[model samples]
Target: MLTLSLILLPIIAGLITLAVKGETAKTVAVVSAFAELALGAYLYSSFVPDATSQFSVSYDWIHSAGIKFSVGVDGISLILVFLTTLMVPFIILSTFGNNYKNASTLFALILFMQAALVGVFTAKDAFLFYFFFEAALIPVYFIAAIWGGENRIKVTFKFFVYTIFGSLFMLLALVYLYLLTPGTHTADISALYQAARVLDVETQSYLFGAFFIAFAIKMPLFPFHTWQPDTYEEAPTAGTMLLSGIMLKMGVYGLIRFVLPIVPLGVDKWGFVAIILSVTGIVYGSIIAIQQKDMKRLIAYSSFAHVGLMSAGIFSRNIDGIQGALIQMLAHGINVVGLFFIVEIIQQRTQSRELSRLGGITQSTPNLTVYFIILMLGSVALPLTNGFVGEFLLLKGVYEYNVWIGAVAGLTIILGAVYMLRMVQKSMFGVTSGITEGFADLTFNEKIVLFPLSFLVIALGVAPNIFLKVTEPAVSQLLSIIK
Candidate 1:
């Protein structure tokens, strides 16, 4: 019942928002998002970490085809679910000052995306997971295309084509896996996992290739990442947040759910290649980010870098690696959204994101500078901040897998600090430029969005156990299956 409501509320609210008039749409969306967050918190409180799945509900949807309307959450699912619910209200709140054209429709699309994200995280069946997986792209497509920058049409097209291309492979792989189910064909994920365990090595390799491509494109790891920065630059801030904060996690989560357990042999065989690509992305993205003059695009490349590390952690296939991935997912989502919102704030006030056209912002806006520094520190993985715990654990995990790769990957901290602090120096600390002379402090709504995120960066860094405990059992279960 809880899972059903969590999935339905955003969808229901989105519909109602479409019919709403004037400012009521934003209010309705915000209120509904808050309600969903409360429900998620309650679910977390009641969740038994040792349990396999909680709030599970399934119904016969296609009797002959063996596909069921199945959805549930375990410890692993809960963390991603928590990230979804946790980020949404703030995503909505961040936009309160901007009067986007057809604002109701924009909010509605965002909420719709939310519902699909929750569904993706909670789905317990392969087809159901894929359904939500593809379903999520639709509203985001509309959001980016309809409400985005001028080149939005072009960027959105690329994003759609690239993602849909990967999704087709996912659908194909799901069908292949489903047919191999014992007795009557079924799409139950657990059953699929059991069946996948016994699959021949060659078949597992094929499945691995299929699953990895889909997730890789979503994670946009390395060479597959071309679509990301352009999409982030062209789309509206809210849309970018959706993409970075929760949408990308779908791919990382899929790796945990599908590729790791179901195709362990294939993972063992091809995992090194995946790690190489991920590490390459981390380096590639960080280098590109350093050269970016556009604030938003810089953050976009930074996201590519951060996600690359998370992917590398997944392939490391050690307890520390997996747990670090889990912790980092939450941390990354919060920090990236904060960075994007800061970009939005700068653009809104100065009417420019050009690093060269911006300067000495800290001289006027103490509040914004403080928040920016905090988020920046978190991104660079400073000690006693949220980013530190995850990056440390992730580095330790990668080190366990192969010291040379870990050594290469650990360069993220140095490179991250270089680009981020340099960005701050040019944008916030130097002499005021003509464009930034009118810079103002964050608005009430902006503070509402940023302060809480800043708080989480510290709280989670200081005591990661709150998030780590929930994922331990699920990670344990996954390792058992992989073994």
Candidate 2:
């Protein structure tokens, strides 16, 4: 029931939002988002810190095809569930300062996307996971295409094409696995794992490629990352938050859930290739971010870089590596969303995302400056900030895997500090520019949005164990399975 409510609340509220008008829709969305958060809190309270799935519920969906509507929570899924529920209200609230056209539909789509994200995280059936996986794209695609900037149509089309193209590979992989199941041919998560385990190393390697392609494109890991910056730049801030903060996690989640244990031999064979690509992306994205004059686009590349480390850590396939990836997912989601909102606030006030055109915001908006610096420090992995523990563990894991790659991967920290602080120096300091001379501080509503995020940055940093304890058992279990 807890799992069901987590998925259903957003869905039901989305339907309600569609029928409401004007401010009512926003009200409904905010209420719904908070309600989801409450459920997430209860879920955390109820969930035991162990590897076993809890609150599981399954119903026959396609009886003839052997698919069931199965959903549950474990430590790994719970953290992400928490992230989705925790972030949605803030994402919605962040938009309060603007008056978008057809506001009802926009909020409705956010709620719907939330529902799909929850579904993806909790799903325990292979086909059900795939169903929710693809279902999530619809609302976000509409969110970006309809409400985004001047080039939204072109940029979103490429995004749509890249994701849909990648998803086909995932579907193909799932379908192939389904046929390999014994007896009744179920697509249960465990059954898929069992079937996959019997395959030859060569076959598993092929499966690895199929699954990796789908997830890589979603994480938009290096070579596959072309669509990301443009889409982030063109999408509405809410849409960008959803994409960067929550939606992209689906890919990382898929890598951990579907790829690792199910295809261990495959991973052993081809995982190094993934590690190389991910490390390359780390350096590649950070360098590109340093060159970006547009704040949103810069953060987009930053996100791309951060996810590369997460991917590399997971592929490292050690306890530290995978555990680090899990905690980092939560930290990255929080920090990135806050960063994008900071960008949104600046853009909203100054009508520009260009670093060259903005300056001296700190003179007027001390509160905004403080929050921005906190989130920025978190992004650069300052000690005792949210980003620190995860990156440390990730680098440790990568080092255990290979010294040279770990050395290269560590560049993200230095490069991140350079670009992010540069952004701060150029945008927040210096003499007030003509455009930013009268820039105002955070509005009451904007404060409401950023305050929690700012608090979380320090809190997660100070006591990451609150989160790490829950995921450790699950990570151990996964490592055992893969081994």
lDDT of 2 by residue, 131-183 (tens): 99999999999999999999999999999999999999989999999999987
* Stretches of candidate 2 exceeding 4 Å from the true structure: none
lDDT values, one for every candidate: 0.92, 0.94
Each model's TM-score? 0.99, 0.99
Pairs in clash, predicted candidate 1: none
Off by more than 4 A, model 1: none
For model 1, residues 116-218, the per-residue Cα lDDT tens digits are 9999999988898988999999999999999899999999999999999998888888888888888988899998888786788898899999999999999
Least accurate 10 contiguous residues by lDDT in model 1: 192-201
Candidate 1's displacement at residue 138, Å, is 0.5
